[model samples]
Each structure stands twice: as structure tokens, then as C-alpha cells.
Target: MSAPISDISGEHKVYLRFLGKARHFLFNLRSFNLTPAEPIPAAATKAVEVSVALGCAVNGTAQPSDIAAAVKMASQADVALVFVGVDQAIGAEGHDRSHIGLPGVQSDLIKAVLAANPRTVLVISSNAPVAINWEQENVPAIVGGIFAGQEQGHAIADVLFGDYNPAGKITTTWYASVDDLPHFHDYDVRKGRTYMYYQGKPLYPFGHGLSYTTFEYANLEVTASALKPQKAVGIALSITNTGRIAGDEIVQFYVHVNGSKVQRPIKQLVDFARVHLEPGETKTVSFALGHDDQALKYWDEAQQDFVQEPGKIDILVGASSADIRLKGAVNLMV
Candidate 1:
């Protein structure tokens, strides 16, 4: 017998061991004085092995339309996890897009699959937001995976297996259509552009995400009755998960100035926190707001840096921009 080896990495060792077995079988066949049939090609052999390992029957290569058929098959399976999102088309390097709908019948595929499988879970993978056409009530769960790095696949598998609870929230709005966005292209110009400048409605407002569990926020408190220029203020709230499963909650804080020399968006996200909680667990989450968040950066003829002006600032706390659970007001005395 050949010398046994244990120093190889797991994946490397698996292939090495397969090669060893194949060689042994071929050697034994030679001793029978009979030639063996043509051996299978390594690439083809690997493909078959991988398919078997994944418990997936090779249904041929997946085309854009095949996604729908796959979903139909998944609907019949025990569980369905659909990974849907825009890839390089709208992510990275691209500053703007001509249209904002699902590309190449992807949405149509999702709709067909979701119709057939109401219990499916949608894991949205995108660098930016997307408009999902399917009925929201039909999907059992939805998770946003925002360019989640190298370990994305592992992280997703872990979440689906209940090994990791999703705790992330939306950083930007998911608008119903491109038209809803303010100036679609120029919103971020020198003077105007941002969620605060936008006029129309978004499909899903910023800082919005659903967890496996539920969380309730209460007891809103602020460190200072009034904010002053060049000073920091603390805002705290208690969050308790009322659901059965353990999960993470993202608490968002928005600021709205009653009146200002310069115009402002309807609301702006100033601070946020992601807190983990077990069932019936409660924790205090807090964040500090400084001159940067409260003040508008304007060119000053005398003073160089951006300055804060006296104004009424509204502090709204909630799960999302559209869902403010609590509200507190403070006047900044410049």
C-alpha cells in the first residue's frame, strides 16, 4: 500500500484521495489481462460529483428563463431560497442607470416562481436597491445582501440555516420607480441631491429591514434639553425583542429642521445602531449628534468651516424613515 498522508488541506486531500482510488482501480484492472473501458474525463467527472454532492439533479445550464422553471421546481421542494438582484449592471463604476426595473425578464421569472411558491424566501443581492414586482404578502421572508463580500455565500447559508440572525437595515431608499427619485441624475449635485432633497416617495424608505423577531422601542431620553453650537447631544431608547426568535434590530434617528435659511430634505438620517437581542431581551441603544449632523455645510465669508445656526431640530426615532416610532424635539441655541 502507498504511504498514508494527513498533511494536506481538506479540499486538496479530497481530490488527492479520489486520484489515489482511481489509480488503484486501474492498476487492479491491468492485472486481469483485460483492458478497461475508456475512462471518464476529469472535468465531466467533477461536474457529476458536484451535482451529487449538492443534492441537485443537473437540469442543464441555467438561462434567464430557466430561473423561473427552477423556482417552480423549488416550490415543490421542501424549502425555497431565491437569490435575486441586479449585478454589475447597476453596481460599481456605474454612476446612473437609464431604467430601474429588473433586467432581462428577471422580475418576470421571480413573479412566476413566487406565484407558484408563496412560501419562498427572497434574498436580494445588489449594490443598490431594486424594485420587486411580486406581491409582498406572498414572500415568507426577504433579506437584503448588499455586496456582502467574500463570505457572502457562507453568511447567507448560515442565516437560512438559523445559524446567524440577520441584523442589517437599508442604508438607502428603494424607490417604486426611477421617476420617484429627485432629479434622478442631478440629485447629488453641489447644491441639491440626497434623500433629503428628493420629493417623490420610495418603495421602501431608508433604514428598513425585517428581522425574524420583533423589537419594541420605548423610554426616549435626551441628554440636553437644548443643543448648542459646537456641542454634542445624546439620545437613548430601550429596545426589546417581543418575538420568539433571537435577532438584531437597527434603530434609526432622523433630523428635521423646522425652518432654515437654506432648504433641506423632508428628513435626514443622522445616526443609527444595530443591536442584538434574544427573545424578550431588552437593551439601551444610544447615539450622539454633533455639529456635523445638525448643521448645514455652507460657505462662510468670515469663518472658514461649516457652522451650525440656531434652529429647531426634530429627532424622530423608528425602524425606518417612514415609520417613526418616537419623536423628540430640541432647539439649537447658536
Candidate 2:
């Protein structure tokens, strides 16, 4: 065993199970001295093993006329759930794409489907960014299903129904169009590469996720009025579920320090917490920060060290970057 079975084995009681063992007759294949005339090639054996591990039972595609047929069926229903996006043919390694939209006739299919059924809910499967300004403006709902392997269908269905409350936050900034992105040939990052430097309006900002229920934030406080370079700072706030159902509210804490010695981001995320509360239930959340998070650090080439600046650090807290509901500040002294 590479790391010993003790390091990885689990001991779970299966409904008060009993332990039993059976001894089998030992057979040595060498004693028979039997061999195949032609042994299977190593590549064929590897391919079979790999295919067995990955399996062939994932979501499959429809035929040429299947999309229109699906749209016709969806037109009669109250809600149309449309699953569209790229597959390994266009999104996998060595498969560089020419555009940032849906692959093949998918864009045309989307328009046709929407014309037939306006209440279409689009589930997009992609590893990279794609333009969805039209869908964002017209569609009732859209879910990003980023290459979630085989069981992504279950997750999509659960979110569509009320079985699971969607609370996942996006990590990357998505542009409204491929034109909004800088050319791949341009190495300059100031053209808006990510959430930290992007100045253009995005369809969905970073740290954005829709939930079934709503939340209210109030009672924001800080543990200290002033902070020292070597010391830590703490923040506290309360979140209440205002809607009629129980859901999770991800409370994020961001810090902005002006008068810094170096160029800084507009706001930096320092900490966050996910609190699940029932209707009218309020929960208090707290976060503590170390030196790096409490102050703006700059490289001191003269001393060959990173130095923290003493200044006022503005603390912003809320459900997301755009929805900050609380604000406070603390002075950092040497």
C-alpha cells in the first residue's frame, strides 16, 4: 500500500452489520502453465480501464430536428427548460474556439426556442466565459453549469425546482460580449482582465448568486477603534432572513484602505460567512483579520521587506460586492 490502508480506510457500521469471512481454494495459474497465444496490447488494456472509469452514460445530444421538436413541446408547457452550450469538441484542450458564444447552430436554436416559448430557463455548460446579454435581458432565469461532470443534471433540476436553494457565488467576472474582452495578443492587463481591474459593466459581477429567499443586514460593529501594524482587527454583523423561506446568506467583508504607499484594488475581500436562517431569524456573524488583511502591505526594497502602512481602513460588509449593506472604519497606528 502506498500510504497504508489505515490512512484511508473508513469504519462505518452498516445498520448494525455482522462481520463474516470465507476461505477459498487457492489456485496457482503458473502450475497450469497455460498462456494465451497473443497477449493483449498494453494500450488496449489502458484504454478499456480508462473508459470504464469515465463511463459512457453522460448527457447526450439530440438529432438535427430534435431542438425544434423540443421547442414545440416546450411551447405548450408553462415553463421551458433549455440546456445549451459547448461540449468537448469545442471546449476541451487543444480545441481553441473562434468565438465566445454557444457552439454550432445553438445560437440559432436559442432564438427559435425563445420565440416558441418565452419562459425559457437556460442552463449553460461551459468552462470559459460566454456572452449572455440577450438572455439576461429577456430570459426569466439562467444557470451556469460549468462542466459539472455527469451528475450536473441533478443539480440543475434541483435548482429549477425548490428542492435546493441556489447560493453559489461566481469566482470570475463575465463580460457582456467577446468584443468587451481585450485581444489575446495584447499582454497588457490594464484592459480589464478580472474583477480586480475590470472597469466595464459585466452582466453578472463577481460574487453574485440568486437565492430563493431574501435577507436583511443590520447591527454592524467593529471590535476595535484602532489597530496596530502587528495586531489584528475584528468585525461583527447580524443577518436576518426577510423572506418567507429558510435560505443561506453569504455575508462578505471587504476592506478599502486609502493613502496607501502602493496601487491597490478598489476593494479587497478580507473575510465572509454563510449563515442559513429561517424566516425572521437573525444570526450574528464575526470575522477576525491578521496583519496582511488589516493593513496595506508594500515592498520596501531599501530594507528588503514588506512593510504595512498605518492608515484608516474602511470596512464594508454585505451579501455581495454590489450589495454592501454595512460600513465602518478603523485607524491603524504604528
What is candidate 2's CA lDDT for residue 284?
Answer: 93
Off by over 4 Å in 2: 1-64, 92-95, 185-191, 299-305
In candidate 2, the residue pairs with backbone N, CA or C atoms under 3 Å apart (3 or more residues apart, or in different chains) clash, namely: none
Candidate 2 versus the native: TM-score?
Answer: 0.74
lDDT of 2 by residue, 1-334 (tens): 0122334433221121222221221111222122223455676645211000111111233465666576676677777666666555555456566777666566556666788878877887665667777777887788888755445656886888778887877777777877777897786665676665577788777777778999888999898888875677888888899998889988888887779766666677887788899889999999986666533565688889877777888889977766679999988776
RMSD of candidate 2 to true structure, Å:
14.1
RMSD of each: 11.3, 14.1
The lDDT of model 1 is: 0.66
Provide the TM-score for each candidate, comma-separated. 0.73, 0.74
Per-candidate Cα lDDT values, in order, are 0.66, 0.69
Where is the poorest 10-residue window by lDDT in model 1?
Answer: 48-57
Which ranges of candidate 1 are over 4 A from the true structure?
Answer: 1-72, 89-91, 94-96, 135-137, 183-185, 188-193, 291-305
Q: What lDDT, from 0 to 1, does candidate 2 have? A: 0.69
User: Which candidate number would show the highest TM-score if scored against the true structure?
Assistant: 2
